[model samples]
Target: MRHRRGLVRLWDYAKPSWRRLTLALLCMGVEAVCVPLMIWTAKELLPPILQSGQSQALRRLDLVALAVLALGLLKGLASYGHYYLGNYVGQRVIQGLRGDLFWHLLRLSPRFFEETRSGKLISHLTNDVAVLQQVLSENIAQVLVTPLMALGTVVLMFLLSWRLTLLVLLGAPLLAWVLQQMGRKMRRVTERMQQRLADLTSLFQEVVLGIRIVQCFNAEERERQRFGAENERTFAAIMKGHQLQALMTPTIEWIGLTGMLLLLWFGGREVILAQRMGAEDLIALLGSVQVLITQMRKFGRLHLILQQGRAAGQRILEVLDLPPEIPQKPNAIALPDIQGHIQFDHVSFQYSSGEMVLHDISFEVRPGEVVAIAGPSGAGKTTLANLIPRLYDVTSGSVRVEGYDVRDWDLASLRSHIGIVPQEVLLFTGTVRENIAYGQPEASDEEVEWAARMAYAHEFIVRLPQGYQTWVGERGAKLSRGQCQRIAIARALLRNPRILILDEATSALDSESETLVQKALERLMEGRTTLIIAHRLSSIRHAHRILILDQGRIVEEGSHEELLGRGGLYSKLYELQSLQARGEGLE
Candidate 1:
């Protein structure tokens, strides 16, 4: 039942390319026909043409030779058409699938990514997709051509000599057994190989992404060993499949040869002893036997390829089957121009595992209010702010923006009205202007410049070798952390969001960079409803209200000065920061 569904889904994807598939199939059919004709013509016509008197033989030979040449020409043209059009369809379908998969990724909630590894997702897009291409380009033709070739050859062999053909047919059961075993083994091996590939990819992604940490900790050798282990696993898995593929060809060859040896014995007896068969008849039967052997071998090989492709298709299906966790409510209205009166009303939340991370957290930021949430790590401060943007839905109760339950708003428009500058600023490998204007791609150059200036990112951008046009290497690795942070700010600034989220945005920068970012934040925050999650006590001093969270609950709430006077979680956090600063001579 499952297998049927998978094949049905695959056919749906192929249906759009039916015209190309039809053309390729036609070419495959032509090639299949040509192979047996060429062999049969050579076996029957060549000897007869020779036996004729020289003058008559010359005339027959010319026609026979031309006919054979024409078959070869047709075969070559059809083979070329089969391969080229097959690739066109395969590539086109793969392009569409990749696009759909990527868009699906965009639709998936953060929860999906939280559980799925980056490398595995990438493997789905690359190695997995490549296997499907093989299925389309090579396996499809093999499916049509191999069976037809085998059936045709068998029919031709029977016409030449049924008794010898029956001897060949005896090996069919063993040949079928071989293919079945190899397929089962190859299926398991291919799945393992793909998994190993994802592991290697994940390891490489992690090691490359955290190269600084690896180098700083002198863990290069450790990482190399880890990657080497994964590489060896992949190599072993591949060789296992290769061994099965290699074994299939020869085993089937030996089976077919057993049939040939029997034919050689019996057919020779008829020619020399019984005098019942002509040499032409024996030669043609032998030629058909060889053609049958070749096509049977092709069947074994194509079976393994198809099995490998089947494994890949299952992997792709796994992702395609996942429904977007944060699918919006049907008929949800667009969030009207947000007045930014954000409220979290007795909201509780948990991850997919249902372990509560936020417990009945309630808070309100009136329009233009700058509310700061201060908490220890893992205290759910970030999780609380993420709710307003509906990155994840509340487990109970409601989060409202502009007095409407967040679920009521259109997802796109809701997100459009809010901007978040997360702690770890991410920048694309593109120009400064491009990164700054990413949230508002249609923003003009002047607007981009204005936003960059507001974020204090303009100065560094201009000093770049190519100014706004400078290419920021992958994830802005070419720039300093402070520079990346500023660009993230500029990106959010350009959106001119109604509500702003500062998720420890300045927490990682040096004092100088933080000062510049904070100044930019102050200017950008004017009259905007803001939720600030800050670890540093100093950064949130100017916030209209401060909520101190601890272990998923708001333990204290007041302005920074009032919280300090209360001597609670907020004060304890402030004391820790002050002591650490004095110890480091920052005070």
Candidate 2:
């Protein structure tokens, strides 16, 4: 029952395709029947014509030959049906699994990505899905249909002559024992091969992403050696898997050879001495022997294939069965159109370490208020801002929007109301217009232009040879860092979100670009709840209020002028920035 439950769990993920799988099985059944019919035709047709020299037997032979030919045609047609329908079912199952995996990964908390490598996650998405494809298309047919055909062959052999059938069946127990052990070894090697393949994929992605770093450090030789080592390990694993698979055929064939020799010696004595078997019966027994051998060979191959598929199926199942970290309640309420009155009430957050990143951090931003959070590098300013969008759940308190806790609102509704412009500028490979209007796909050309203008992106975008139609290349590589930031801002602007988050949005720009971006920021901040995490004192100088954070606590909070007068942490930071701006420090 436990094993049955495990298989049921695997198949449950291939939802709505049980009907297609049924059709594939029906086709396989037709093909299975054709095999025995063709064998029986050969057994019953030829002998009478050879011995009797009767005209009637010749006519019977011709009729049986035509029937075998027709069955052969039917088998060919069924084979095609099996391939097409099985492939269709496999593709559908993979599509559904990939879609679910992708959706789950995208919705997972940011910390998930922080701890996981991009390459490893990508391996799960691509290699793991391909493994499932192999299982569905190849292993499913073998597991379901091959064994039935083998069993039917054995039963038919017994009906023809129980003595010969018993001789053949004598080896089945020994064969089963050998195969069961081989299957265990195959499953182990298959899993190790999959793990090594994932490692290779992860290395490939990391190298590509950090190619510039590799070039800068002149570490090309180091990277090549690293990649070569992983590739060698992957190669060794695959060779081991193939070696295991290769053993199945010869080992099973040797067992069959021993059993066949035993049957031939004993059955020949029965026919020659006892006169108990007719020529027709001898022919039938020969055909049955050949058919039984064919079935055993297929069974051996099926066992190996099944083991391969089971290994991959188990891996795919691991990801599909990952319980969602933040699932919506059945009766979850849809959030109303937000007014952007954001409040973090006694909000405390800890990373997986249980060490606090934000400790009892409480703050509020009224609609149309521009609030700035300033601190040293590890002061949790960004973490506090992240809670507004529910990127991470507060450990012990509530982050509310318009009086409702974020956890109570549907995830999509809560996220749609907020737009975040991260410190790192990420843009897909696409035209400038598409990149700018990324957040709101249906935005009109005029709307896109308006957003670009507000972000001070239109001037440079028009300066490019292709203007808004130009490709950004991967990660907007063709554009400068400042250009990418402006494009990101344009995307957020087009969304027209109720709340805006700027995480050092101007940190990458030059003085000229920064000046333009600051103007754009002023326009963006108007009539919206804005949370700014800034290191540059000038960027948040006009903020309605500023909060200084230190060691996960709000050490100081006030207006820019008020904080300066009080001479707290904010005052010290401001003084340090002024000294640097004046070139009073060593330069």
Candidate 3:
């Protein structure tokens, strides 16, 4: 069920910037009081100025006007002050949330990324957060001030003439009814607006990120159609919201005008008959009526703003309420200096659907031992490697590093001891030196060069137009896959972690690049406990042990020669590859 959560929850973001919020409210309060106070002062002096019937009395009227103008000037200054403080608080809160979201994303399990679309998550972080910002800084600030202003105007009008005020008062319930219905409609529409906007943002993200794929697959027209449909839906939602609001302003104004006309006929008769009220009192009453009308119109619009803000606030609260899936336990012990002993003891896991990905797998690697895992596509080789880093806790067993369960160790210290090179080498747009030194940001120039040379990337980097200073371009699109892989290897080497996992580190490279990367890998794996996930038989030939995985279990385990000699699944795979290499057809 979609519950109606309000602005009280939205104020949680202001906790970090409470001082700014307080100052903004203070400014708003001062302005709210000033509006009616200025009106009351205008009403007070007008009687004396008109009845005196002298030039000096006209001077008093001029003075009263000047005082009213000064109050208005103060109100303008206060409005600016309110806006400045509100926006400052809003921006600070947004910055805090963004920082937390980025850190949390780094900690999420790899499966989290697989299930959640990147475009949708990006929409949450960017577009959704921005909508909440507009609500917090602009609309919410007005919500606080407008109600006080409207109530103040009503009270002043009542004091001026209770009789006419009663008639205006009669319309109050009707106005409230109008606002109530419109606010409810606006809230519903606002939620739809936010959802549609997120869809639009996701569409744009998908199109931009997969522009190459879209073009290659001749899906340009299809994507365009999809995006246009999304945009139309967004436009429709916005128009529906505005349509309700459009009715609001005109209806409130017409009601206020009807009250004003009633006041003119009734109050003018009181003045003409020389009743209890004077001409000046009638004027004051009319003036108060004018102030009431203006405030009521503003009040109606404020309802729409508040409803929109409330809807936005609810969306933001949902994100803030999502408990971290992997929170640090209280008093978690810091991991000791790792000697890279890793063990997976009867580890088992499944996806959210409970379809098992890894069975009761058990394995151990001593310090400085090299293990290679080969598998069919659906086997759990990658899952087993991931368990060591504590990316996902085992469903039934334990993964330990250096004798301590990874869950008991400080997550930061545990991750710091491990380095990983993924199958997809994602390079950011930065200098070659920067990319290589990413793993060890504070590494000196000599250390960077040493790591790059070990990875066989230094020679090619120096041969480029700007040497180490050359930009890699977006996702390293300017560099060959081999060059990007070499840089990734250099980054891992610079980290000099106690444990390293290379997932198909050289699979995409040509033979020449593979030879270079292999030499670099040899240097990198020298003293570290290394686990390699490989498809090519030659990559695992030198490993001390190789485990062949199929259907989430180890089907074969031995050295490459032993596996071949066994003549099982590994031998058949090897034979198929040997035949392909010799230009023989598959049977």
Measured over all alpha carbons after superposition, the RMSD of each candidate to the real structure, in angstroms, is 2.7, 3.2, 3.6
Record all residue pairs in model 2 with backbone atoms less than 3 Å apart, i.e. clashing.
none
Task: Please provide, for model 3 over 205-281, each residue's C-alpha lDDT reduced to its tens digit, 9 standing for 90 to 100.
Answer: 77888899999999999998998888899999999989987987787778778767877888888777748676666
Instruction: Give the runs in model 1 whose Cα sits over 4 Å from its true position.
Output: 1-4, 49-53, 182-252, 475-477, 582-587
Candidate 1 residue pairs in clash (backbone atoms < 3 Å):
none
lDDT of each: 0.85, 0.80, 0.80
Candidate 3: stretches off by over 4 Å: 1-23, 43-53, 221-246, 327-336, 473-477, 584-587
> Model 3 TM-score?
0.89
* Model 3 deviation from native, Cα RMSD in Å: 3.6
Output the number of the TM-score-best candidate: 1
If scored against the real structure, what TM-score would every candidate get? Answer: 0.93, 0.89, 0.89
Worst 10 residues of 3 by lDDT: 1-10
Compared with the true structure, what per-residue lDDT tens digits does model 1 show for residues 1-587? 44446678767777898998899989988998888888778775766565877787777778888889999999999999988888777777777777878899889999999998776687788878888888877677778888887887787778777877787687667777876777777778877877787677678778888999999999989888888888998999999879877986687668778777878889999889988778888988888878776777678778878877887888888898888888778888785576888888999999887789999888899999999998888999888888888989999989998888998988898999999999888788788888888889999999999999988989888998889999885744388888888888889989999999999988888988889999999988998999888999889999999988888999999988899999887888899998998887854
Q: Give the best candidate by lDDT.
A: 1
